[model samples]
Every structure is written in C-alpha cells, then in structure tokens.
Target: MNTRSQTPIPNVDDTTGEYATFARVQVDRWRDGQRETVEDVVAEEVPIALEYNGISHAVMMATPADLEDFALGFSLTEGIVATPGELYECEIVPGCEGVQVQMRIATERFVALKEKRRNLTGRTGCGLCGAETLEQAVRHPKAVAQGGAQFTVQQLHAALEQMQARQQLQQATGATHAAAWMDAQGGIVLVREDVGRHNALDKLIGALAEAETDFSQGAAIITSRASYEMVQKAATVGIGFIAAISAPTALAIRLAEETDVTLVGFVRRQGHVVYARPHRLR
Candidate 1:
C-alpha cells in the first residue's frame, strides 16, 4: 500500500500503486480528405474500490491520482465519517483489476457506516447508486454557517481564469473535470482532476482538509455543471461559496438556498449568474 502521491503518466500498467491516470494510444485521423495515424491521449477511468475497516463499501470509476485525498473526501462527504479525525489511515493498493483504497477509520464511524448498510457501485455520473429509498438518495446536510466568507464578481472571474492553466490533467487528456479551491483573493490554492466531476470535488475536499484549510475563507471552482450532489458535498464541508463554469441544475439551486450556500453558475470572463445567496457576492 502506497500513500504517497504520484503524477499520472501515459499508457501504463495498473500493477503498482502509481498507476497512470491517462493512456496514450494510436488513432486514425482524417483532415482535408486525408487519412493518417496519430497518437492521442485519453483519460483512464479505473474501478476504485473504497474499503473501510476492511469492509468493502463502494466502488467508483475515477482517474487514479490523488487517491488518498479521494478516499478521505469520499468518506467525509458520504457521511461515512463526520470529521477528518475519524479517518485514521488510508492505503492505496493497485492491482491488475483496479485500485483499492483501504481505509482505517474510527470504530464509532465504522459502526455507523455498517448500520447504514449501503453497498454502492458508483458510476462516473451517478452519485446515488444502490440507494433503496428516496430518503436515502436525496440526503440533505446541515446548513452551512452564516456569514462566513464572501467573494466578488472580479475574484470569481479571476479564479476562473487562473484555474484554466492549472488543470494539467484536463489539458493532457481533455476527458477529465477539475475542481479547484480558490481563496478570497482569487488565487487558486489547489486543484484536483478526475473522470467524474464528483470525484474531482471529493479529491479537492480531501486535499483541503488534509492541509487544514479554512473552508469559510475560500470558494470551490468547478469546470463542470453544478449538480445537487455537488452542492450537498460543499455544504457538508462548510464551504459557503461555489462557482461553476457551466450551468447549475434547478435542484442544486434549491439545495444551495436551503443550505445557505452561495451557488453561482455559468461563470465566464464577462459575467456569471448567481442562482442562490446573491449576498455572498459583491
């Protein structure tokens, strides 16, 4: 089991913990009525199994990078663990079939996880997998703290601009989504990329938590549409502001309003749309 982080490379085997998140392959190209062969890079989605206290909990298809962060983040956002302290140790084990993140969590949290009795096979786009009832599927977290942090339109736009250059994985494979943590001054603090947008956010959250980041003083910037699950994750972690480069779902807006999260979407250089809690933005 390797917990150290590694950079993703092209077209590598998965027998080791440092598995490649992208692969380079040959592709047929047609341009101007001419056909040729070219090498292309594509994002690799692996079945990442999350095991808590040696019990298999859920499996998600995600890029293999910053997986330790992913494990902690998933645990936190999925309510498996109430706080980062509840998660003790995370081991990244790569195998021929896929990767397994074996986590050792607090006994109390593990007991609660077992009580929920959820065995999810999560896909890249599906967040609520194997949920039996509506209540289990649409979970609402506690409301975020009021008047924690605020950002202006200029800061949001500047963060959006800075985030583009920091997305190394997306620039390589063009098949991954990115989630970045931006401070109030519009500086991109950290970025995480994954095949699944939710996974990316989870990874970012995990990294931020590991660094003891102040969730109230920064915003989450995502390069995908804002979904209800995204808002739920942010609010659960006490993130007061979120900005998306694309549109946000109606359910996401409603949850943001209910959770006192400032949700902004369609973020561009010109302007952006504030769907909920406009007071958070200047």
Candidate 2:
C-alpha cells in the first residue's frame, strides 16, 4: 500500500460542520482487463499521543476526529479515571507529525495512572502493548448490573441496518470501524468511527458519558469482532448489551459472562449468535 496523505487534516463542511475523516489520494486501479491511475479516499490514520497532566502516556494510531471524546473515554475505560468528573480538561493539538490529546485529570487519577506504568505504543489493529506485568496486561472490570435491558431480534436487525446506513466514514473509505449506541427500542442513537476498533468504542463511550446517557439502558454495536478488551471497556461503563458484526474471542466470552454482559457476535441482518447472557435477546 503506497498510499500517502497529510497529517489527518480536519476538513469541516460549511453547512453541517461534520469533520471529513478521509483523505483523497492517488492510486493505481487494476480492473479485469485494465490498469489506470485513480483518485481514491482512504481513512486517515495518525499517531495520537495521549498526555495526562503534561506527561506523555500512550501513543496510538487512530483517526483524528472526536478526539476529545476519545481522550475522556480512554481515560475512563482504561481505569485511569473512575468517573467523568475526574477528567477536568481535554485539549487537542494537531501538528505536522500527528495529533496530541492533552488532558488534565484529577490528581488522584493521574497518580494512579503513573503507578501502573501503562505506557503503550498502540496500533490501529491492536490495543494491548507495552504492559510490563501480567496483572497490568489483563485487568478486569467491575461487574455490570445484571438483568437491565432486553432487545428483540427484530430490534437488533433494525439497529444493525441503521448503524450501517449511518457510517459515512466507512462508506467513503471502507477502512474504518464503527461503534454505535442503540437505545432500548433498537434505535441507533450515536455512532463513532476510527481506524481502530477500540478507539471507535472509546469515542462512543465517551460521547455517551458526555451526553449524560445511562449506559445500562442501552446496547453497544460494534463493526469489529469482540475482544476481551472490548468487553472490559463496555462492562467498566455498565453497558449490559454488546453486539459485534463478527465473532467473539474465547476470552471475550469469559469476560462478558463474568461481567454479566450479554455478548452477541456474527450479527447480520438475518441472524446473530449470543455468546453470553442470551436472555437479553428475546
């Protein structure tokens, strides 16, 4: 892939003010009997350095949009902060190299983060990196409240359709992942996209918290396979339902069961497989 782009430029639409998350690049296309140069749009992936109280923490490859949500959500889900209030300020600084999310969190939370030594070099495809200990590598989340929300199969299908329709970035680039929040009636309320699946989920989680929505009252829909980290993030925020467009890892199933989350995978228009707490789907 010899595609080239500038440092994740944010092109805002004049009317809607929606950030353009893709970059136009020139590429060679080989068809059945032809080869030609063409202009294409690719999802933007850039290094996002997260700084806490001026201390550099993890550097991740992610799409540079909704970064404020990403910082807050990452802080909360990663156990750096117990509540949203613990995070006082989030500032995004874009540079020629990449983007930086400068966050000022509660003193106690920042102190705890330093104690864990959780410095990471994260890629778009992987979440865990630079963990020095087994305990730090695989941390468990608090168990979510049991038996909170239920969704019918029809609602699941409807939400899946809605989410797919709403993913403008994926439609444009086909290189991004989406995470959405589905209300109790299966209406897709909020969606976030990123080059990294975990980043998308973190954005959605952060947006939900910022909107003051009850995490336990709805479900999360992801366009990627469910990993243990995904389950942990959702459970940490008390989301009881998680539906993935692909399969679930064994570790994800185990964590979902332990956290009282209803995990569903291979979600399509016709069917889905429930990996845990099947009763949540009627």
Candidate of highest lDDT? 2
Candidate 1 TM-score, C-alpha based:
0.93
Worst 10 residues of 2 by lDDT: 6-15
Runs of candidate 1 with Cα error greater than 4 angstroms are: 1-17
Query: Which segments of candidate 2 are over 4 A away from where they belong?
Result: 1-20
Tens-digit lDDT track for model 1 on 155-254? 8888898899999889998899999999867799899999999999999999999898889889999999999999999998999999999999999999
lDDT by residue (tens digit), candidate 2, 82-159: 889999999888766777899999998889889987789998878688889988878888888867778899999999
Q: Which ten residues in a row have the lowest lDDT in candidate 1?
A: 4-13
Model 1 clashing residue pairs (backbone): none
All candidates: CA RMSD (Å): 5.0, 2.9
Candidate 2 structure, TM-score to reference: 0.94
